[model samples]
Target: MKHKTLVLSAAVGLLAPVMAGCGDSGDGSDSGSAIVVGTTDHFTATKPNPAPFDPAFAYDTGSWNVLRQTLQTLTHVPRGGGVPVPEAASHCAFSNGNLTYSCTLRAGLKFANGDTLTAADVKYSLQRVLSIHDLNGAVGLLTNIADMDTSGRDIVFHLKSPDATFPYKLATPIAGIVNPKQYAPKKLRDGFEVDGSGPYTFKAEVKDNTLVKGTFTKNPTYKGDLKVQNNKVEMRVYPDAPAMGTALDKDDIDVMLRSMTPDQIKSLTDKPRKDINLTEMPGLEIRYIGFNTSAPIGKEKAIRQAMAYVVDRDKLINQVYGTTASPLYSNIPAGITGHTNSFFNQYGAQPSLSKAAQVLQSAGIHTPVKLTMNYTTDHYGAATAKEFQVLQSQFNDSKLFDVTIKGTPWKEFRPAETSGKYAVYGMGWFPDFPDPDSYVAPFFDKDNFLGSPYNNPQIRGQLIPKSRREADRGAASDTFGQIQDIVADDVPILPLWQGKQYVAARTDITGVEWAVDSSANYSLWELGKGTTTD
Candidate 1:
């Protein structure tokens, strides 16, 4: 397949001035006027840091959340969810066999400091990201770009190979444009200062690790898709979900976004509260177990396949996750376009000791295969311990293998997993975008994100590149389906479950359902406090 030509429409002009005021209505009821949000994620800046709010360096979800509001990318995903829309760029397109991508900046655009935003800034920002090449950052996504060119108001990127999803990558926070004058070309900025053209600006008095303190104000010079509903948005950081829930009940916080445990969410369902509103959205998150294929135990395809057959996803979702998640049959979750039940079709829903035994027996493998499963105790959530324990019990009970479970904190576990210190480990994925490619491309690539020695020539060499050339994403579904089937057979990773997005807010707060953007990002712009809903 070859890319011919493509073009995008002009970007929208700057938004008009919005009315802003903060005060409680006098009826002993706080109409949706002001909002205080609670979260477990924290974002801060120190004297000496590698990436202080620099889009190129910031990789964590917390930092990206803040950048999403303060920085404008070339394209953006809509509030509810949909295809990418132009933001900073008036138009973006590809020509000459998908090797060339061109973007035209919106006319008369300027930074919050009144400095002109031009194609040169775009070129510099992208080149800087590539130059820094932070391991923790999303720089790998831009590896396809061979070179970039700049004209009067246009920037062009020449890709090493055809990539249909390249445009979708530009819509992410990692592609946020930075002012060349305010930011250094090489190193990240040191202080807690942001000079973005997004809808909001970070308040100077921001304090991290403090509850109910940090705030962001509407940027007067900003122009984008979202209009700032509240004059000031306060963010409260909590130690755990329980603390966040308590704050929500006590009116200390209007809404809670992330890090809520399944038990906490189940409690809300078990005992309904009139004063609280709970909204759930279909999520693109998937939890899976990655196997180091080069390791002694993981080297056996039959052993991996037997483990998959013996494990029960229903128990994981119902008992461990309290039904907050659904059983996932493939790497691609339900919300994504190419999601399928390939695993289920290959191996039935229930764990079958007989089928697992047959698979191992056919491979001439002995009984009671010794395997150790590694998982992070602190990173995933409080329930991760129980989840791994459940997995341990299932494997031991199957009588096919003797399973030993081990745990480590996320900080240590991440490096260990990436270094292949663990033969088999568990990990979860929160999508970079709500596309089927996001599921397969990253995990199955030659140099995959998992750090596991999983290299499938068919998937890495042919399917991915072929799919990338298909401009219509939906039409590429067959390729993704084939990829998932191949993965199920290879058994490099076992898909466990897919989680649902949940947000618990006070009844007075409107737009709870709309708070989560199409890309699964919690957008503060969609939130409001009042009886009326937009």
Candidate 2:
């Protein structure tokens, strides 16, 4: 999963496209003037490092949102929900029993800067990300590639194991092809310009080394599967959700997405805006509490289980998120296949002081378990402080635990969480793709994205590998279910609630429903003024 400021999650093993949803007019028509899209998602990039647009380093939604329009992958997740379809590549398939993945580059592929985008460039782009292994980069998801070779127009990957999910990984921004000449092979390329072969080529504006805005215009050199529907897309970064909502209300921006405060959502839902078209879609984003299992207090399974019993997901959703989100019982949120209410199945639907006490008493642990919960201050939203406050209230009210709350900025909070500095911390996950594996593998694997010491040998060694080998992703549901059950029993990460995507665009805006897909990949090419027929 690519980390959003809030965290990110994944989907299927099959290469076949699984189509769902409808909105866009498939015609390649550019009918709209440049439109501004606003969001609260931050564009973070430190100096002397790969810029957020550099796919090799960026692992966040704000950066990927820009990269999606500028870079073309071998394959792409469809406009609706489905498996990867050919983008830069004309065709792609597996051989050697799903261990070898090969793709032939589309004829006459060229970057926006007029550089030839050959298979060699694609090979270099993927390899460089692995070699650099930036801490914030997505090298963990791509560790399966044992070796790769470029033959003429074809790029072949030799996976170390039978991984059917490899193709899905290829569809993500992490696998976005970059020009070898412009991008460094051993380190991140510093600068603002990007040489990509997607529907649009972008020039980003950086203020004090942070991405302020990105202007995307149609690339005549682009020869990919997607057709540009809008002439230009200008993505503007806003300070907060209220500011973004104000921009949407004042018509300063044509579209508002990524995040809106629950108060804003409740207000708009209660009194619909005449000029705004609010479209709600099933979201794959989830929020949860992760424990540092290596920590002294966190190492106790009873404490984790007791905390799970005391957690009130309903109250958290109702008080904090309103109707914008639903209570989540598993890491795999609803809408994705193989999702289960594992936490609810184990801990029941509501918080129970009796159950919390019973669990601790049964484990021979002392009453009033001492614990601390941590959360990010600026990463998620202003509402995050209130959300954690609610969590603290729940924990303290249970009378079975004494909980301390700590809030830190994202930059400081991320390092502390990874270094096992926090006992339990809140996190949000947006999917990398629409697969169950994205939810399970990233959190449960030996080298899990979270530095939590939750390495279950059964899950890491047996269940995940077996599930990845199954070509028919539907058949792997049982394995994913088993994995979720194990996670629920172990109480490594406690699932809290799942979010719903709310996009507010002008009435004349076409293809708003198709703009953000299940995996939250913003398809700027699908957004246009009025209807395509006009």
Candidate 3:
């Protein structure tokens, strides 16, 4: 119910390890070597998954790394989950109980073409995503904004509903303000035609601009948390993780662009060359199992609860992740406020087969009940495939039931899960903000449950509104605790594990702070090939 879609395993884009080169000082700039990086992206991934180049379309972390550098958001979170600072807007104001919001523009906020970032740009930018109408997960988020009016450097947003969380939504790259004049009104605009205001502007694009570089400016107007580090950044997109790892080992690249699986992390650690280094940060991402509430299995709360009992999360985390990640019972990822281990508290201490069987029998579901599980292949990783298989084994191992596992690519998987074509699928949530409301809202609210999965009244009716109305995020902990209990009782989806953001960098690149998992913006601001004197 948490809008988690199960995608299939993809064989594409995984990278192979590469050898290293010591003397490739990146054009001999103050930042030292040009930091080469690798990702599991094709040289050009135009269709199916939204391309990163287009500001309006991309959801992948790989795309955000490039977008964050090229296009600026209105506000940003610092290295950790700190208060957001201004980027496009120097400061913003919200009146009328968090609905009518306004932002004062920075004096010199201008696009690469030197066009000022005017109020009209902000209005158009916000409207464009709504107009396009296809940016996944954005429609519900933007449901608050009634209209956006821009006059000169002043931008105003009128909300359809009163929401304190709106500003945080504005900070997301999907809601990123752009030079509205360049992006067309009603279609997914990605590629050479797109434009933005950030530290970098697209200087050159090859392989459909999958390989892009952003020129850095003083960005005097950019007073946000995302600071500009190097003068320029060149992003090279590889097809998959293995190749990205290969490139890093060979020194063909500077840092591994994104997080890798436990095994991949191990290979980099065990086979570490002098040049390669590992930077393991607590990630803000959470992955879970979402049952299609629209489906018959979801109709029975007992069946969903049974699924949770049978699947061994500890085994999944330790065996599949190899100590790289921690198993989680709560939808909230670790490190974020309001995180609770509801699953462990309820089931971890004693995974009783007898208890699980008894619970099912009491509910009139006899032994040998069957269910199907699904996943998205390329969306997560090879580890995701193994994860689903583990679930299948977990349930089938229980002589009380039968489990079937299947998956599709992310592109197909999103729609399939949304349509309730599958009974259950592997689902993951990378928060838009670290707030408890974000975790509570997306899955349980009827509108947020895009795939027609499970929804609970405590979460949707009472808990959601109560959480949102509060000015202090931490104030809603009691309600959130109730929401968790409701979820456990409903048993719509089983909580799996919380993930950490893992990136193996060459020793030279330092000051690299991976933004919180929810932001997904890997700006080159805090990054340098090594040290910089300038």
Candidate 4:
């Protein structure tokens, strides 16, 4: 969780509007011209993309048209991250007081392969989420769907109980529809091969996760909703931020899709601040820590609480991450539902080792307790190294925990956590949907728990279900409040800080939405070069 994060923008940028790559429309593709978007990873292609391009395997929002594009839910998510609207489904009729929801699918909808997008495909996709739990990220979103049935293109959901908020859930990528034919039932995807009915097709995948775009002139096309500016797009990946900035300076890249720290941006902005456009949106991302209950050192709630207190969150934010991050007390963060001071309401400022020592001493605990902290080095950038160093000092200085720090790269980091390799771990969430459910569900729940396996019945059984049942968000506050309260008590995971995101682009790029910390690529479909649009 450097400690944890999420972003947009406009301006008089450099790179001088190129006729390269068929011009920029939001399809996330570069035409025959091959737009050179630079990421730190050098995302140059070494292999072709893999197909079935599923979101269920890994919660990859970065993929276009494959999972997210081919499928449309009964509803649509809004810009502010609230409610949903009818999408693939023309309309919905909720019976049994919103518990039993029925929907009518839009006519003429079909997959890229020409398979009619049907109620069965929707049923297969949602049920498949529960059927495939080992895939890591797909289990949480489907935990609520009790059962599915089809009547023509209309599918009805029979919930275990009445839940009004289920409609909003259909908008997430986790619940996205996929063709049952191509992908093997339990297999997970490791590359960019995709086939979908979205605005673009998965043409090619380059090295380091850069995606090549193919035309979307197929069934269930969305050409009417999008303005096709370019025929192909290229995503370039770099290993780190400095490398990304270098690419921008060399004009090897057009837009730096996300922002760095204020200082980092100021360097380029001040030199001729007018030359580069820096756009920022605050209060979107949530960063948190789950003390491994599964770990011998992290088993004690008192120790987790102590670490949460002892480590200075504000200092970590200012020094390690610069001004780009905002400290948060709750998992829901700010600008979203279920916001709370529950963490701070329980523990104030920093933790007092004196108090921590007493908690441990009363528990008859031993001092110099050996603790291991794990982090992903390359994934989080320089901020991660700084965060690890700061925490190492904090724990060692506590005189309570004898600590060992482990740093691994993302490739290893991804599986190690799921397999339960670390005592205390770092995790950052990029929300799958705008709703509070997306963040809350992924980390908690008894059966669907992500890691460190913190289970509270009040949450998994009662509170979460009640919240899901309430159509009105305000009515659902008490449920989330209870969830936060229990989180304070269990201390399985510590709340860290929410981050601010910035995207730097040349002055000519346009149509970029500047707000939304949910998913970086969700609205990129609307992004364009040279002009702005709604």
**Candidates arranged by lDDT, highest first:** 2, 1, 3, 4
Clashing pairs in 2: 8-430, 9-430, 9-431, 9-432, 10-435, 11-434, 11-435, 12-435
Give the top-scoring candidate (lDDT). 2
Ranking by TM-score: 2, 1, 3, 4
Candidate 2 per-residue lDDT over residues 356-419, each given as its tens digit: 8988999999977777899988777778999999998898888887888899877577767877
lDDT of 3 by residue, 1-534 (tens): 111110000100111123331323432233544555555543234455444456556655555555666677777654544555667778887798876888878877778777777777777776877777663445566766788877777888888766767777777777777876677777776454446777666554565545533333434444344556665555565556776677776667766655466788777667755565565555557788887776777677777777667777777776687766777888766555566777766666446688788788989987788777788877676688888877777778888778788878766777677767877778877776656667777777755634555656667767787777666666666777888877776767677877766666665565444321333446566666653221
| TM-score per candidate, chains pooled | 0.86, 0.91, 0.85, 0.84
Candidate with the larger lDDT of 1 and 3: 1
lDDT for model 1: 0.75
Weakest 10 consecutive residues of candidate 4 by summed lDDT? 1-10
Number of backbone clashes in candidate 3: 38
**TM-score: the better of candidates 2 and 3:** 2
21 Cα displacement, candidate 1 (Å): 24
lDDT of 1 by residue, 250-314 (tens): 88898888878998877777776666666665566788998989899988999999998999998
**Sliding window of 10 residues with minimal summed lDDT for model 3:** 3-12
TM-score of 2: 0.91
Instruction: Tell me the lDDT of model 2 at 209.
Output: 68
